[model samples]
Target: MNPQHTRAFAKAAGRFSNTDRIDAVMLARFGALMTPQIRPIRSDIIRFANWSPPDER
Candidate 1:
């Protein structure tokens, strides 16, 4: 999450005080309002490939 956006949203909501409790509420509200889209996992991840050349085996 972007810190600038967080601060901006909190400030807009009249939550200038940056505290854990206040942040929790702000973030929860942000999530509810924004409903960010889910993305699939990257396909670049390593996978098992145990095969070797027949001659070498």
Candidate 2:
């Protein structure tokens, strides 16, 4: 889920303050209301696997 969108939604709902409590509520509500596409998080290992080492000079 997009944090910016969630925060913006919270702001639109008059939740001006940002706290863990507010974030939790906003995230839950956003997920429930928006039903955004879910995707897996890329790990650091996956990033390194996509890179190649430089050849010797």
> What is residue 46's positional error in candidate 2, in angstroms?
4.0
Q: How well is each residue in 1-57 modelled by candidate 1, as lDDT tens digits?
A: 566777788899998675899899998887788775656655554233544466863
Could you tell me the lDDT of residue 36 within candidate 1? 57
Error of 1 at 53 (Å): 34
Which prediction has the highest lDDT against the true structure? 2
Q: For all the candidates, what are their Cα RMSDs to the real structure?
A: 7.7, 5.0
Per-residue lDDT tens digits for candidate 2, residues 1-57, read 777888788889888575888778778888899999988868987888889988999
Most accurate candidate by TM-score: 2
